[model samples]
Target: MGLQKYWRIVFVAVLLALAMIYREEAERIVNIVVSSPPWLFFACLFLVVAEFLLQALRMKLVFSKNWAEILRAYAVGLMVALSFPSRTLGEGARIAVMAKELKVKKEEMAAYVSVERVADVVVLATAASLVLLEVHPFLLAAAVLGICTFLAVIESDTVYRKVSRGPVPELLRKYIEESRKIVKDRALFAAILGISVVLWGIDFLRMWVVVHTMGGTIDYTAVASLVSLAYIVSALSFLPGGLGVYEGGLAGGLVLKGVPHDVAVAATLYERLFSYWLWILVGAAAGAFKRENGSSSTA
Candidate 1:
């Protein structure tokens, strides 16, 4: 454990060193940030708050829990996700914490988490495919076909029964039962997907605002494509908050879209400042608050 801790520190140090290596670009990023209008910063902050609230709402719909507990779990989860190497662990932490908080079985919570994860990925991929329609028709078709197939399978009772009768573990069977309950409710399923769409739309808007704040311009479609691609790359990279990978993908993609390198860097940094770093702070505060209330617990 100690060796792993040291490796994490060394990894972060290397990332910092790389940032300093580009002296001129780093200076430009600082200047761009300093010169940006204050209102835009507040705007981005508001969007972040909105995003979290929406996320909590989605959780409420899934878990049927009180608002306070749901938000606290979500904040703690976001914190863990940003601080850790893989998002899967953070989500697992969230499922455990929330299950304990609600006094429910972990398998039950895990079912909802699984569905939410799939819905989010499907929504993101669909958005990316639509944006890339003209540029990559094959990708659009594949994304569409994949999403449809997944939904059909999840909604099919025959498949669910067949899996249930198979040599599935008892815990996974419980999870599957819960998942079937969720997907069986067409209204609930649609509502969750709707929330996901709105959530991702806010993300795209936030990115657009960040770029404009840096005095850069890009169309909304381009912004959607860029943000989707960056997130996909980051999620696959499994880096904490996508970290260097996300930053690189966003800035490089923006440059490819004709934005200046400095501005692209500035936009990426500023967007991450609120979307990623700020959430970490919020999670810390939530964890501290829960602890202070004598409800401290670990995932």
Candidate 2:
């Protein structure tokens, strides 16, 4: 980690300590997860393994023609993603690993990784729309309806042709053409989208299990949307795997949806146990082994 990140974490830790001390309403978060049933604890473990498998499948699909490299790159991506914040560093880290393992160019790897992240955006938007409908019905419904009408118009060749002909300069035209090529590649888009949906679904189910264990009244789908929004916020926060921010967002979302505060806190803690901590332990071990085996780059 960089010095900047180190200091930011320190700052965040201090702030978190203050938050815990001053916020009288905040229940003891860690204690709740500790008291959850053994069966539920195992369920969390199952979910993490499922999450890793889904990511591996996503990477494999991202590079369909290069299955062998995909396997290596996927593992590398998971390691980096779990070790860092929001998986933001995952692509570059994977590219380095791919270069060593498969002698591939970083630029080519970048094109695939870029497309992979765009897939994530599309999935998040879809999840957000679903969640908004559940969490904020009126506004979400209007937005969804308006977006659907807009997409329908865009999908129509007549509308596209009309929009395409106008004041487009040469440079802008080339950019548009390239973008069209990227978007129109149905196989590539399908692979990315398919894997992303599956990954998110597993995560949602994991969240659902936590609520079930806690005996919370919130529905599975409702928990899913809340998970989606919490994920988005955590991504924006830039903390490693979103750390404190993610847990806080999960708890807050549940409270907003009328869950009792203690249950929300317990559920969020359980989520960390099953997902974040698992990733940290596994990814860190993989990273350390790579270093010892001289399989990783120091640069």
Candidate 3:
């Protein structure tokens, strides 16, 4: 746990360094965002908050017996989004913390978090497939296949257990058990999936608003596909909320659709300023509240 704290400190320090070096670029981006109509800007903010609310509701559904545990789970989810890949361990830590607070076994929490993450992948793949014809068809097909495999493994108790028992070592028995639990919790998993999709949709809308503010000629499909692809990349970036990587990916996608490179860069930066940083502040506040209140998990 101490090591994890040290890693987080290092990650924050690195983010500060990067932000300082790119201060001019970041400021330039903010200027464009400020120039946009206030209503449009506020709309984007509303969507972000809505995303969080939906997630909170989903968490409640997932841990139906434990209202307090739901908050802790949702808080961890927010923390995961705020820090992203940089706090890779934070996801697992959140699960561990929930288990500790709820007096549940660690394996149970692990099962839940694992289901949450896998559901994210399944949800994204499904959504991407509906609009698959718009982007790289091959990649979309691959995503579909991956989603199918993931569902097959984690959503089936008999098959998962059979696979776990065959060839795999006895060391992985706990993993099999947890995966079975994930399968058993279908209703909660679906709820989380719905919330995850809605969250991503809100984020796409926010990006679209930023693009419009920059006077881009892009349409909804263009905006959604590009933003979705960027998210897929950034989610795996392992950087602090994918800071530099996300901005670059968004800019690149916009430029590919014929938007001016500089404008794309500026818009991406502005969206992050309002969205990412704002969420970080909210996550920080929630974390502080959790600590101060000595909250116990009810899972």
| Candidate 3 per-residue C-alpha lDDT over 1-299 given as tens digits, one digit per residue, 9 for 90 to 100 | 34434544776587568658899765665566677787876787788778767766655654554665565556555555456445465566666666665666777666666766766666556555534656568878887787677667766768766877688755356766765665667665666777777777787788887787788878866777777667667766666666656778879979888887667977887787666677656656766777777654532
Candidate-wise lDDT, in order: 0.80, 0.65, 0.68
TM-scores, all models, native as reference: 0.90, 0.70, 0.76
TM-score of 1: 0.90
Task: Identify the superior model by TM-score, candidate 1 or candidate 2.
Answer: 1
Which residue ranges in model 1 land beyond 4 Å of their true spot? 1-12, 130-142, 295-299
> In lDDT terms, how accurate is model 1?
0.80
lDDT, candidate 1, 60-86, per-residue tens: 997777888888888887776676666
Q: lDDT tens digits, residues 163-255, model 2?
A: 578776654444344334444577756876788888888888888888777867788777877887777677665556676678888889898
Q: Rank by lDDT, descending?
A: 1, 3, 2
Query: Which one is best on TM-score?
Result: 1
- RMSD values for the candidates in order, in angstroms, are 3.0, 5.6, 4.6
What is the C-alpha local distance difference test score of candidate 2?
Answer: 0.65
